[model samples]
Target: MTASLLDRLMDLETAVSYTTPPPEGERPFTYQAGDLPILISAPHATVHQRRQREKGEEEFTGALAQLLAETTGVHTLYSCYRSMDDPNWDRVSPYKTTLQEIVQSRGIRFVLDLHGMSNRHRFGLALGTMNGRSCPHFEPLILQTVKEQFQQTSQGTAKSYEELRWNHFVLNHARFTGGVANYTVTRFAAEQLGVPALQIELCSSARVVERRPLSQWRAPFRGQPDAIHQAVILLQSLVAVLQAAI
Candidate 1:
């Protein structure tokens, strides 16, 4: 019997889930070694706690990282289980400690942290570069490439999204910009690791084509083909931009 690609990704996630907490003293993030200088990460793919409240999963970021690794042959890291600490928010998150080690050991030059956002936002995507402090040299290239990709991919899609093209690029907006006072994962990578990093926030519309209600955030929805397809296009677009930067 043969299993499909989606099945393989699911199996991978399940296997990672089992070893999430580790035996006693193991790292929280699973690091997959790759030859490329890029390290793709999905830190919010699972349920996590932040300031005493339980946060919902981003839905498909784990699968996106896996697919990017399989397709681009790049290193990937992701949180496997419900995190005891918010890796992106907590300044002392253990995930950051291990991330520093990985960056040093693997000589990673770039960190691409993937995240998902609510569809209530105007744009389908948002790039956070900590106000050009993260990746000053490559930020413009990243922005240009992403816009081009979206325009190209949306040729056959809906036209109601025209507003997105005009107001899509939110440069260092107030929300999730990784700017000052924000000790996010990408910020740590840029400052401590000395590597350029960008936080890519994807809208739910681009992934699952629906703004999932908060009440249903915990439910598993990995088998959705449309969501997976959208993720692939976005991943490929980012890969192209990274390759150019390299």
Candidate 2:
């Protein structure tokens, strides 16, 4: 199963070259429609430009989004090519525009924007809801669900809740407060589209099975299979609960 997961992620990683845009007529992102009212987005899955500066890809976030969609039947939008604009940082971009269109047309009620953070952070997962401005009605349930899911032991996962809790799980940390200082996809969907949104940032250990070969700077690192397994289960649980409640 872990090997299958790695292969699936690699397939997504190869869909577009990390340093190049898609063909002239192609979009930088791909959207998959699903049965649930939730929309999963991974805007930084590939290299992106912010204020004329380039930012590295977030490793496996795109693949994670796709995996979530496959497992839970939730709508998904993930960047597949290098971006000329930062969808998460920039106030306006084609990606955000497309997101708005998807939410409107698909009657999406909740948006879960996926992102990745460095392993140096002292958290397993950090959820940003703009300090509850976004997803106000569902915040408590979201929190409860996350805590419960991560604490439980699934069939094949090797990590116990105690082991996973070493880093911790947090909500609304000042550094990643849903980009309150800027217009993030979470903020945009919540404010402009009047849809609930949450920014779910996974620590590197949870999200990345292994860095792609194209990554240049960081020494090659592989995430524990147990951690990845737990993450997948946790996210799948969130989607299941949200779909039922929403």
Candidate 3:
């Protein structure tokens, strides 16, 4: 293991119980911090285990999250869905049961879920939740950070969410459509569980095409690296915000 991985764990509340269990032949283990007030979870990670896949969006963000981790002294993150699992369409397997068990066992405060959209509309980080269910003012701060970062990266010329049009139809629909658990995790994790939650959707064009005007992700995050990096930055930045929340 790398030394930085060790550094990722210090005051963390110790994670346990993944959404799925791995069999005897898994390559390795990918874990996250469960109970910290700031929980950065990426639901579009991959299958790292034979029967289980554990990872999050903040793992790779051009080393920005790593820098934040060191500067902020943070330790905890989560991922429940593989790139193939699109909770937006329907919630097939909600780790909510597992998350509930963890939250009840550990008492987590906030849940920040990382995701990306292919809707041809969204552009920056989103603070979508179960509708006025969480920190209502979350979007403003998230937008501020994202816009600031956009200016810093020299990555894209896309303005903040305000400058673009947003399809807000999927704001608080916790109940899955067609049994596919797309936004179910965030909805349940925050609304049902009473845990303040945030869902961030990154665009796929920047990651897949590596060009301007990121295309909205239609399916799942099958091949998107840039989106993952952006997710990481958002997660780490949110962590800092949580540190202030407490």
Candidate 4:
């Protein structure tokens, strides 16, 4: 975590990817990976507290993990387990800001906003549009990658996921109910900030990268090697594509 964020946070962190806890269920602040040209974020990945919206408790978390992929190269890392207090989102949100400052200073290639949606809900990840969040070029790229990913999941052509993830939550237009609702961070980071953003909403029950069982994807469980490996792989691939386009 960056000194700037740590100074303003009441969160705790550890070497363990999932062991640390926050004073208010809010994860620690990070920004060391802030220098990376690319970013990977997970905003809806809270620790699963009982009171998701307690007076001072928000329940969503996210990250900027391009550093994990481009560790040796030029990349960054910023992930937050905000309890609905998306640091990358509205100022009204309680979480402090980090991503916006990094983008304003760094030539960020792409902003990957990672998240997970519920089957109980009607949609999958809400890959938010970059229209009002960042630059104009960010819009088409963000939309296309999400659509292509959805198409791959829906089709039998995808080999990594083992089974086709053609669940009803496939990418539809932004007009769908709460379509961009969950992706407000993406919008704010991309269009409003003039940086490209891609909101990645993975379904909690979606098939694993290796077609593994769905029981493993609950919460902070990303510590499991399988889940982390999957996240790393997809994150690396996406950054490569984003870098190429830039």
Candidate 5:
């Protein structure tokens, strides 16, 4: 990765965490214009109200989306402020509405939703494509590319990239089949808007440092350079795969 890219990602990591939420009536997510037909997104980048309850931020996801946009020249939509609506879970989310408008107006063909899971989660990354229902044409390619990139980047790590192959936890799996949750951004994009979409659930070891009172608050990489480096690698792999696929 270029120093500039890493530096920019570092800056974004801080920005996403410390930035003040916009006043009510203002959109929480910011759209980064791009010429590519692919759109990168991070719906849970910050805390949000979901199903009448507050949900914790997903840690570096917004920065990851921004990094992907910078590296791959793809359109991006990321949550920059605390969400008033659960973009991924709400049935009528303004995020999705705006997504539809962008897909239609910009002729976007792919939507990649990035998320982060705590270290408590078993897998390093879990890819969701609405259980094979979303992005019928691009799911296989997306899945294959992610697997290959993981194997290449995580060869000697504690997590065995090869083992992940047999785990088969990435797409249409039990924990997050992207099925039954039609309100999810990916499901809505595929089912309603007719655009292919996928949700990538990343484990925190690669992106975050969970703090006290775990539910709705935690810090991003903060002072941890290693965490940031790993996140950068993940973003680079994702951008490489996406560019190839696109």
Candidate 6:
């Protein structure tokens, strides 16, 4: 089962090269349309440039986003090549522009912007709602859904919630408050598009099964398969509950 999951992740990340651009005329991001009214975005899935500095790719975020879309039938967008600009940081970017198009055209009611964080942090998952300004109406429901999902045992895994070590899930964390001070994708989707949005920052241990071969800049490490399984189930549950609510 772990091997199958890894193979799926590898297929999703095959085009994600930090140093390479997609063939000429192709966009840097891939958008998968789904029947649901929700949109899942991973803007920093590939290496991105912010103010002339290059930021490393958020490993496995793209794969997770794609997997969520596949499993939940929700709209998905993720960067698949070196980004000329930071979609989550810049005030203006092609990524944001495309997102606006998607939301408007697809009648999207909610947006979930996925990101990656270092494992050094105490929390396994950090949810940011721009201090309750982004998803004001759905904050309580969203929080409740995440907490409940994380507490349940993951399918196909015998490990209990405590054994998975994913009990730490925080909201509006001081370090990751949904880019309230910056031009984040969540902020753009909420403020500009008038859509409820949340920024979900997952620790490396919770999101990645293994770093892709192209991402050699990151340290060598493998995430526990059980933790990855639980994270996937949690996100799937969150999407299902949110879809039903909205």
lDDT tens per residue, model 3, 60-164: 221222234445554333442233233322334444455566566666776665544453544433446545555565655755666666555444543332333
> What lDDT tens digits, residue by residue, belong to model 2 across residues 1-246?
877877776676665356678789988899999999999999998889999999988878898999889888999999988899999998989999999999999999999999988877767789999999988988899889886765564433464434555237889999788878899999999998999899998888787777777863368988766677777877888888788888
Give the winner by lDDT.
Answer: 6
RMSD of each: 4.3, 2.3, 9.2, 8.7, 4.0, 2.3
Model 4: per-residue lDDT, tens digit, 1-246?
A: 233232212122221133234557444444555444776654434332223442211112232233343342434444333243444444444332566666667777666666555434544344444323443565566556556655644564435343223223343335422124543556666545656666565554331221112222434422222222333344555666677777
The TM-score that candidate 3 achieves is 0.52
Against the reference, the lDDT scores of all candidates come to 0.70, 0.84, 0.43, 0.43, 0.70, 0.85
> Model 4: what TM-score?
0.56
**Tens digits of per-residue lDDT for model 1 on 1-246?**
113554555545553341144446665567788778788988887777799987876766776687788878778888766677788999888888888888898888889988888766776667888889999998878877766766665674545456433225565677968655778988999997789998888776444422234423645333234334555666777776786676
Backbone clash total for model 6 is: 0
Candidate 1: clashing pairs of residues: none
lDDT of 4: 0.43
Model 2 has an lDDT value of: 0.84
Q: How accurate is candidate 5 locally (lDDT)?
A: 0.70
Question: How many angstroms is residue 210 displaced in model 6 relative to the true structure, after the best TM-score fit?
Answer: 1.3
Q: Model 4: residues >4 Å from true position, as ranges?
A: 1-27, 34-36, 48-96, 121-125, 130-169, 172-183, 206-234
Q: State in Å the error of residue 69, model 1.
A: 0.8
